[model samples]
Target: MAAYHARSNSFPSRQHPLIPEFDEQLCRLRSSEAASSSSASLSGKLSGLQDLHDCVDKLLLLPLNQQALSNQKNEKWVDELLDGSLRLLDMCNTAKDALQQTKESTQELQSIIRRRRGGESSLSSELKKFLNSRKAVKKALHKAMESKCAFSLLNRDQEVVSMLREVQSITLSVFESMFFFISGPKSSSWSLVSKLMNSKTVSCEKVNESNEFASADAALNLLISHKMKNSDSTVEENAQKQLQELEMCIQDLEEGVESLYRRLIKIRVSLLNNLNH
Candidate 1:
């Protein structure tokens, strides 16, 4: 999709010339996401979003852009932009909570595994609890994704308003992917464990390994199942490895999401300032 609406000939040449570069960054993010699911892919996507928002912040700060957005006829689009910002904030917050919950649970499980003296009974009990926590997190993420807002088609001639809409569009798309990776890919018929198992090569894991969330879940489930069946101790080692990897992934995402949350707030504040001005 076109990342930003092209300005008409009548608009001044100096008015937000970053729009083209913004489009380039947006396209690069989408392409990178489609090509890989490595640890670096998620970080790259978040970094790309930060850059895109920086461009948007600059656009919002432009005098002509603010003036055009504040025009009486463009009030509806302005309200829509504000509303869109809120939706983005809500989704970002949901993602943060889910990641934090998963991180804590994963860490606890890892600690339990490390202390093999805790005995098989204790390990099994903690495994079940960890799986249960993951199930709840998945349900919450699914609900948030389901309840995400759809952008309304607003009729507006102003380039500034169109850029705002594009920002919302791209922001939502990136978050949807991040949430899917964090929560595992969507499936209607598959149960929590089954879905993650089956989704290894789906949207988020086509080219490479499953996302850390899904991979960790699958490994844990497999380890628990083997334990129930009196399997080898090797499985426990692998499961611990997966949990450690997942913890690292969560840390990177936690930092990235926090930064992006601040960026979203900045964007929203700029929009509100325009409305107030």
Candidate 2:
């Protein structure tokens, strides 16, 4: 759970878009009662979405987590999860691209206004500041993109739409499985998991075929280890092995985020430099 926490400062990441929105609302809320009420309502709605995202993250990791308990029984299901996660990773980039495009559109709109103003009026200075802010935002986004390694499977932003559809297909399949497996009449024991599964926020439609960040081979090895022994020590050893691989992937994801954050920090620096000048 703690592993999934995002950085405090940066653009809204795909993983926790609400957090940034919440923060922005908080800043506005500081100035007005109306803003406070609006933000509070928004926060309420965001919480549900946050719950869904977090649950999806955990479900994505269930195969590895279950290995820790010596109960790896689902090779086929685990493989499916792996495939979904791979597609998810590829799709996550799409989410980021969408965000960038949205920001770019906003900047372009501001640029048009800035051009029309042409620095003739009192508000021209403010318009110039807005333009500078937009430039800085673009720079930060570009720097982040430059610093992070591209997704190995897919690199083009033009593919984001199709890739997103693919991800949604996988998500729906996962939700369908969870709906039946955890929420089925016979599976009352998994009620909590069932509830999360039922969350309206997470679902994907059918894609031809797709997949996750997890390797099928590693998952298979873990399954073998669990079947070979029920002893605590054996499970512990295998769990540790799975942990090592999971951590590396987690770190890679973190690095991608860290780049965006670091670039944002530089944007602040650049902003200050411009103000001083």
Candidate 3:
């Protein structure tokens, strides 16, 4: 009986080392997974930051381009362009807000991970923070796009209209890309992926198509009006000279509009294909 008791006790003693060994192995595996997840989160955040930077760059350029074009146009166009400039500033502000929120979320996630004990999980807290940040980012992007599209539709300011159209198209494309990134197959979170992916593609395509048609129509109208004005001019030397200058300006505007249309079409096609695939 004493021998039996000794044997039974030795069995547990033999298994004692295995418990810590197994725990160590589990901890190592969990650590590896945590590290991978952390890396992925950081990479995603960096990509978002880069996108935000690009959007800001484009927003800055919008005002400068509008100013340059407005200088070459009528006073009405200048006022309109100035209004558009205010809208662009609004977009920049929204983007900055989103970026700020995302930065905070990232810092929070890092803090959670840092405070995690060995063999304890921090994934839930990290994912929660990330989702909150993503929601803010999406809201900001949506507001910016809506503001840009509205600005594009404003009448009597051809320069502002043109700049806003470009901004609208680019914003839609960027939003689609960001949506895909956040909801792609390899996304860390899977809860809302399907819903986001389903509706986004169709919405982007419609917006793009509508904007392209509007841009084309605006260009055509401008060209036709310029032609009509030139045709009604008297054959006086000064009138003829003015007509020629107007015609050249009209031609330049037409060419720029055509280029913009082609570029927008290309973007639309590419976005459609990407969405389909």
Candidate 4:
């Protein structure tokens, strides 16, 4: 919420016992985000963020850290941290909304497939509906991405504030990455199928295989454009498989984000309570 400035070298109290563990968790998360573009890895990043925030909350509970943060002279940084928390909450809630939308659409299509509701024409119609729902999700994700969260630099002596600001910065980065993952790469002239297949040199095997949503999209597109037969059991099976994978991924991400959201709430309450005291 404060004017964003580059504070690249900032670190928490050097002697704080929890700082090492916190740093390790943060580094692991950054490494995980950089090492892969898979939904599985993003789920891992969410877990690592939870651990990192737990450390932050623990630090907040320390007598010396509380004393520092609660000082009236530190009011500027306190306001910044509080505002940062709200931004994080907004980002988390947006991600949850997108994920929920995706989950519902996926379930609807899956149900139709399981019921063997109709012939190929009917299935194609439902698949088109599903794809259209995905476009809405992507639009929401794109707009959410535009709301940037920036962390501000604090005085060198404000160790606790510096540490929290760093946490906010990294958390913002991870959320942006998650939004991109959920949105499943922007559509272009290349087409989702081509992007999944030949867009990235290091892409995982199969079409957009690393991204559950993209893979599902590719599968559905094939069904629609190819006009596959209703009697083709493999066609239905593959579509079902992709949808199942997406459902599993959605559940994992939903749980992770919900847990992380709770952690953020707890941290915010702790900060408020400490300020009051």
Candidate 5:
């Protein structure tokens, strides 16, 4: 797919920029925290997202109700916008896959750092190289956002436009959640991330705050990031805590997906009512 680099200003009420960012998390621990269960939860959420995407795609493929149409039928907008929405959703899924890969990579990096005290340089170099290789994914993501944004302008006067807009918003929100756990592959981005994940001496608390963290959530993130930073705690203990956090995030995602599912259903029901009228 051509990398569709669409800026947010290309549409109105833009919530986030198309700038690329990568985020990922790694962990293991708590007696109550099951890596299996956390993994399952994440898997379930991704599946639910896939189901949602499929639902929209199927809806798009349905024949347009020409019988109920007026002379000014622009029903193709429905199909085209749904196509764009699906493209964006696919991009989000690819991002989810990338996040999953990062988790595995983090595990490998952690293990290597443990066995080879002097291997950090080589490992860091490899990680940065890996990130550069993923520039295509970054471009695809930005392009997907642009596609969704374009849907907003298409068929603006149509009733279905409102529903497509809602779907676009929900899809973007899901992407944001998935991206939270990932960090950039850039040297500086990975430098802090690796240290937080692997170095026992460095404290997330002591790290200088960046200007990007001006929101109230930034304070909470600092606390959570502090927890993620390595400490004197046993590896098992730390893993348990991290998994617990992961589980919480997954549960939140499940709720969001469920909510989205309900909303989508409502939109479908409303459309049916309109058609029958």
Candidate 6:
């Protein structure tokens, strides 16, 4: 009985030692798993922080790029506007100069017409002299026409006709240009005066057209003088109206440009506020 009791106690002591060692081994395994989990979490957190930093860097660069692009566009727009303004100024100056030149020409033409009216040469005597000279010229022309020298006569006649036509065209063009400047209703208040002058000239044309040949020539001369006088008066009125209209248009344009500039400035300010937010 004593030996059996001792054996039992020894068995208990050995089992107790094994239980402590097994418990220590289990603790070590649990600690290793916890350490591995912590390392994985730390790695994940570091990776996440790196991704956030990269995203932040990209986000910061995006606004800078947009700002740079916007600045370039604004500079280009400003340059274009400056160029356009200079061109407009040049055009305005040119128009002003043209207006002055037109005024001066109209004045000179009026003086010439007045001088022509004051002359008292009888139309009958002038017509008679002209007819006599024309008769001689006609005889000479007929002689040339009768000649067998075809090339020479043809060339001479063509040259004279061309010269006369050129002179007439040049005179007509000058008269038309003057009329446009002086009598234009779009530019000046003189349109009323011009219209009144036109009525008088048209009446003179009717009178000349109804007269007998000899008296008709005299009437035609008188009609021409009246027409020239009317034309000069018309031109002066038109030019003034045009100038006034141009000035008004310029004023409106300037106001519009200023409004646009103010609106653009406001838009830029708004954009800056949004970027800051």
**Tens-digit lDDT track of model 4 for 1-277:** 2222232223334565676677777777766756666777888888889999999898888777788778898878888899999999999999999999999999999999888677767878998999988889889888887866557677766767887887888888889988988886765212755553343332224544448888788777755655444465654676788889899999999999999999999989988986787
Cα lDDT tens digits for candidate 2, 84-123: 4444433335324533443443344334434545433433
Q: What TM-score, to 2 decimals, does candidate 6 have? A: 0.23
Q: How do the candidates rank by lDDT, highest first?
A: 4, 1, 5, 3, 2, 6
lDDT string for model 1 (81-186, tens) is 8999999999999989999999999998988888865687778889899988988988998899899879987654666777678778877887887877877764
The C-alpha lDDT values of all candidates are 0.76, 0.32, 0.36, 0.78, 0.39, 0.31
Q: Which ten residues in a row have the lowest lDDT in candidate 4?
A: 1-10
- Candidate 6: segments with Cα more than 4 A from true spot: 1-72, 117-277
**What local lDDT score does residue 74 receive in model 1, on the 0 to 100 scale?**
77
CA lDDT for candidate 5: 0.39
- The model with the greater TM-score, 4 or 6, is 4
TM value for model 3: 0.33
Alpha carbon deviation, residue 103, candidate 3 (Å): 2.0
Number of backbone-clashing residue pairs for each candidate, in the order shown: 0, 14, 0, 0, 14, 9
* Residue pairs with backbone overlap in model 3: none
At residue 83, candidate 2 shows an lDDT of: 47
lDDT string for model 6 (124-148, tens) is 2432443343234334333332431
Q: Please tell me which model should have the higher lDDT, number 4 or number 5.
A: 4
- The TM-score between candidate 2 and the true structure equals 0.25
lDDT of 3 at 37: 27
Model 4 lDDT, residue 258, Cα? 98
Question: TM per model?
Answer: 0.86, 0.25, 0.33, 0.86, 0.41, 0.23
Error of 6 at 80 (Å): 0.7
Cα lDDT of model 2 overall? Answer: 0.32
lDDT of 5 by residue, 69-170 (tens): 211354555455445545554654556555444344434534543464555356445434434434444455455545544444554344334334545554
Which has the higher lDDT value, candidate number 2 or candidate number 3? 3
